[model samples]
Target chain A: MTQGMSLIVKTITRLVTSFITLFGIYIVLYGHVSPGGGFAGGVILSAGMILLLLAFGREQTMKIISHSALVIWDSAGALAFLTVAVVGYLAGDFFINFLSTGEPYRLASAGTIPLSNMAIGAKVGAGLFGVFLALAIFRPGRHQEEE
Target chain B: MDPFMLLLLALLAFMIIGSLIAAETEDLLSSVVCVGAIGAGLAIIDLFLGAPDLAITQVVVEILCVAILIRVVLNRKDETHRTHKDTFAVGSVLLFLGVLLVLGGWAMTTLHPFGEPLLAGDQPGVAQQYLTNGLQDTGAANYVMAVLLDYRAYDTLGEATVIFVSIIGAYVILRQRGKLRHDTGNESDS
Candidate 1:
């Protein structure tokens, strides 16, 4: 019964994190219509990552998700966002809309808004995961010799 | 008195109390908490005065500032006041008080908000058009997002760069500073 209970709990945690990540994607995608946008969705995605970190050991998580990759993701996300804004600036007034205003409430709508939200989500999720790894893995007391 | 006047008075009273507490506290942590309270009081004033965005920004910024300051203090040894010189300090305090009085008097007398709303509904004004047309034009739900990402995007990019730089700094500081006995490939030969 105890083993079964543990299995159930593990499954629940995995399911919950998956659900949260999916919801985060939805929030970023539908940010044009909803209260939740890039910033909020990014935080939500980070929360999902935090859950994964909790379920899996630090070593396992680090093996799958490296710090270097997070750094690259953060940089690339920010650069993409800046590039879009610059393109808008060069084409029109400062930070003006350059892309076509597609049919409203559609998947491909909001021109650069959806793309910007995706950038934000990527930056925030990776940045927050980096913070968590720093805080969790680099705890002050434990030494390498202990291993 | 009007509701706004009452709210202003309450906020002012809270500020005075928080300032008194912050001033009396010798413990740096306690003083920081008191300052945080003052920030919250100011945020409440912003909310009551119909500036929700400013209130949210102020709260987040204040929390970040306090957290960063506290973290720095934690990493340092117990600090002692090294200087006893009071001449310049006394003059500076008096100068500050004088400036504070002038600002307070101005605020009390002014009927309108201190600054004009830079962004308003669309009327062909330089800033207003962005706010008015942002949702319709960009399909962004939040006007604040439109402004931050669309209008002031360069500034946002710069801010993100600053965060990345700080992360690198923190990683360096938290890493082993002393020379390792075994030269890892990660380290330079020098």
Candidate 2:
């Protein structure tokens, strides 16, 4: 009975975590038309990562997610955003809408805004995950020291 | 139900969840995380209400604050060591605060009067025009960027100066002035 209860709890947690993660991605992609944006979406995504860390051991999680990779990705994402903004300035004026604006309220529309949002999403998501990993590293469990 | 009603429901739900988490968590760090989560939710709600400026600022500031807290908590020696008395005291305090909050919120709901659409206009107010026309005039799509760069360029300059000043202050406090002094055997004998 105890084992069954534990299994149920684990399944529920997985469901919740997956839902939040997918929801976060939806928010990041549809931010311009909806309430969620880069920051909120990024944090929610990180919450999923945190859940993974809790369910899977820290070592297993770290095997998949490296701090250095996250840092590099975050920096690159930020640089991409800055590059686009700079490109706008070099082309004509600062922050010019470089992409062709499609039909109003279309997914393809928003003219570089969506791209910028994606860049921000990447940066924020990686940055936050980095923060959590750093925290875990600094506070390893007692069993870790013994090993 | 109206979209506004839905938003209000979400906000209220968040408030309740935050209160419950804050109340139930015996660990200070977990309570702080709950508070941070609540703050992030509030910021999202603000964005939905068409206040991106406030939302961005809140999100960034809160993340930095949480990062600092995480750093501190990780470095601390004690993770969990709470007596029954401490738990009781914390729980009682949380309950009292929650009740007081509920009363205040109820009063606010009753006393508050809805206002007209302050932003209803064709030409758009100074703020709106700045958001719309700033891109055309100064060529920036990010509404915040347009506002900060063209309409409020002076303010941006001031903020940049402040950032520079803070950086210098930090360097002054943290930078090493001299090279490390090594003690060789001869030097120690001398």
Candidate 3:
């Protein structure tokens, strides 16, 4: 039962997972200029990871992404976000954009906004994936009766 | 009404129908899917209302919610066992629906029509200020991003903290359960 889906689904998941992750990164990086931002992109990214878990099973997925690593990544993302905000306080205001604002519409224009978005993306993606992993791995007491 | 307005109205009707089905459905899976459909419909309506940022967020949120719900449903029993229907329960539900209809009708009559600005004498509202100066002030072309991360960053930070704390809570609760299971398994083995 833990073996997950058939070979076809696994193969398709392998083929598309990278692209989905890439698209998610694209959304995060271009959040200042695009429709999708950190939260949306992060959810999409975790969805891709979840798709992998569904296709390849929990054991195989955990081998690639250990539980401890997920916790670390999740914390790191939150810390990075807080650090960005704290850095703004150097300029006398909390979360004030202190970095030089380049020309508008450019990728580099949104001083710390893009960085903040990336931090949020990483945090949200890892947090959601961790939640999914916990829920999926949990077996209720009722399931033991069937066995 | 214009074609766009008609389309939006149609979408709203579908959303209402979807919500009704979701509420009344006997099958848990179908009910979850119906709710998801309503969420998607709401995202589309948000898009039509010229809030692409909200639309994007709504769609992604809907996807995440549906995915989590499906995961939960997969583990649980498929059949939804309804409790014995009582006359009191039925009467309360009907009374509540009737009251809701009356209140909704009254609110609609009293409130300003949809698509109109809320503030009567708009002396350049906050939204207008954000639209005009968001790009120049924040150097982010997307006004929503600018507002969320810059103009109203405190609120965003608070939300992020809440999410972080919630995740930690989940981790702690699950960890305790796993440890308890391990201890029990070892004792049985011994």
Sort by lDDT, top down from the best: 3, 1, 2
Per-residue CA lDDT of candidate 1, range B56-85, in tens? Answer: 556644654465456445555546665787
Per-prediction TM-score to the true structure, in the order listed: 0.65, 0.54, 0.88
Clashing pairs in 1: none
Give the Å error, residue B132, model 2.
Answer: 6.6
**What lDDT does candidate 1 reach at residue A113?**
72
lDDT tens digits, residues B71-156, model 3? 88865665757689999999999999999999999888987777777653268777788888887899999888999998998898
Alpha-carbon lDDT of model 2: 0.62
Q: Residue A86 in model 3: shift from native, Å?
A: 1.8
Q: For every candidate structure, what is the RMSD over all alpha carbons to the true structure, in angstroms?
A: 6.3, 10.2, 3.8
| Per-residue alpha-carbon lDDT of candidate 1 for residues A14-108, written as tens digits (9 for 90 to 100) | 77988888987887777655545665576667667766665665665676787778778877877777777778879976556688757666667
What is every candidate's C-alpha DockQ against the true complex, given to 2 decimals?
A: 0.31, 0.06, 0.59
Between candidates 2 and 3, which one is better according to lDDT? 3
lDDT of 2 by residue, B1-190 (tens): 7888687678969967996997688776787698788878878887777787568657755765576576456545545665567888889999999999999998977653543344534546776666556544533345554354334534533443453345345334333333233544343211
Q: lDDT score, residue A71, model 3?
A: 81
List the candidate 2 regions with Cα displacement exceeding 4 Å.
Answer: A1-9, A140-147, B1-124, B130-190
Residue A42's lDDT in candidate 2: 67
Candidate 1: stretches off by over 4 Å: A1-27, A47-64, A86-96, A105-108, A139-147, B8-88, B103-124, B177-190
The number of the candidate with the highest DockQ is: 3
Question: By the TM-score metric, which is better: model 1 or model 3?
Answer: 3
